[model samples]
Target: MKTAGGSDAAKRRAGERAAEDVADGFVVGLGTGSTTAYAIRALGRAVDDGLEIRGVPTSFQSRQLALEVGIELTDLDAVDGLDLAIDGADQVVDDADAAAHGALIKGGGAAHAREKLVDAAADRFVVVADPSKLTTRLERSVPVAVLPDAHTVVADRIRDLGGEPTLRDAGEKDGPVVTDNGNLVLDCAFGSIDDPDELATRLSAIPGVVEHGLFVGMADATYVGTDDGVETRHY
Candidate 1:
């Protein structure tokens, strides 16, 4: 499914702005999604202009895009540390507290597992989004990647935690949407999230869950794209 967010122009503005922070000798974590695709392209131009950098892509889609854009690819295991990670959010809660300022709901693309790993390993993780992604509170569905065999059990556990879990199906294909890691995704709805961190912890403790979409305290900043320009928010 296409990710729900702002206009394509706004997304491009935010993404390009985030790419400005990548230095000449940096190792970047390239995230998946339409917003992040702009950043990858921007970085590609920079590389064409003699900027030296390597990228660790968070998903197969991202890796393919990076290659097409002429951005050199590297595996996460080969990188000692990533200088930065440019990513997108499905929804971002604007909180006053710095700790929760950029609390995000991701995985609309069902790549949260790899995105989380690469993003968390970066020295700085920046989120790019259109204004539509910003919100007073998080009310979006949280996606959880689970082992195929444990999907039913995980759904029961998610229900015990007061969430409604639905297996994400492939829209064009006949079977369920399979992730790069060969797992099934369960999109869980829990109305408005009161404590994202607590919920994140609980989701992580689930036996079969590979990763959950609640990215609490991961983003260092967010660049929100507007019709006119981009607004940067530090978390």
Candidate 2:
């Protein structure tokens, strides 16, 4: 039996297309999530093809996945500037066709902060995702990373902001799901996030809050994959 890793093969092919866009010998920033799994696999193929590139994964899961795929990995301290970052976006949209201008909600893997660190260090941040994620406005479904000791206090603070916060879990494990950064994650549902930038900034400012998963102005361009094919929207 030939299983397609529980994801569509065409989606994986779309990741190949994006990987082809990457030049050899550049420091790449790897992202986390299911969609990014394909990208990492594709990038690994590139490495096998004799590209002398080094990868810096955004999360421990991403790092492990990259190693399994044959991509040479590196640490942040070893590299000063990242040439490119190929990762997945939760959502995307175009603002008047003046390149792509849509905010994104990420961090489902609880590695949002590390993703941001790599994205910020990169020269170009390329976001990849399915077409269904495109939206005119950013909705905050981002899992907020916090300390377990302050989960209740943080949830209350979020509730005061009209957000019903729920502690993210790994299916009744008798405890909270811990992030790669060794913090607890809160899967927050704040309805339609009217202002993602402001909300992200505010949430990040809160104490005990390690990082929020919303990525604003962090993408240079986005590649949206559809059932038919893929398309690029530069921002």
Candidate 3:
């Protein structure tokens, strides 16, 4: 329930807790984000201890981290399915539908497109985050990945949908932030999201939109870390 900026300790707690679910001989989807990085490192330690598992990284960052940690890497093409996936969210809220897991706003790192594919393929998807990432309602800017040539057109369509879209710029480089798939990101702010599913559909309806940050009913559980401990919420 905490909403302030999450401390480093909290992020580590949530991440490491999620990593405990990984088992030997399982195929795991390694997610991208600072919190998920801890989970990756933990898995690396497990591998060092002789726990064998294959990882399908959701982003270049995660792929590099997985290699650095010595986790064996595999692509989605090589695996029929994943046993589990551990990811992080920019913001999370309980799903509107009671039977569904939860709604999440991701893509703060511009990797949501690939993250979605890897996550949805897993039998179980777990979200690792600090309490600060949870919210009663999702209001963060939604990231929409679009083809570079279609960015302008997508922006116009997004504006017509009553949302303000800003092309995300790279912090350490010039020009717009380019995704690993060679797409541009539009961080669209829609204020408080009343219906995430409806919005997700609208966003996906736009041509050239590769993916969006709204993750509705995708998470199976969320591990939220606090200053002193961790809490698990099941959907």
RMSD (Cα, Å) for all candidates, in order, is 1.9, 2.9, 2.3
Residue pairs with backbone atoms closer than 3 Å in model 1 (clashes): none
For candidate 2, what's the RMSD?
A: 2.9
For candidate 2, the 10 contiguous residues with the lowest summed lDDT are: 1-10
Q: Which candidate order results from sorting by lDDT in descending order? A: 1, 3, 2
Write candidate 2's Cα lDDT for 79-161 as tens digits. Answer: 88899887776656556442226567877667887888898899998887765567876665668888878888888888877
Residue by residue across 49-85, what tens digits does model 3's lDDT show? 9999999999999999999999999999999999999
lDDT of 1 at 108: 90
Best prediction by TM-score: 1
Instruction: Compute each candidate's TM-score over C-alphas.
Output: 0.97, 0.90, 0.95
Q: Please, what are the lDDT tens digits per residue for candidate 1 over residues 3-39?
A: 4666888999999999999999999999999999999
Regarding TM-score, does 2 or 3 come out ahead? 3
How good is model 1 by TM-score?
A: 0.97
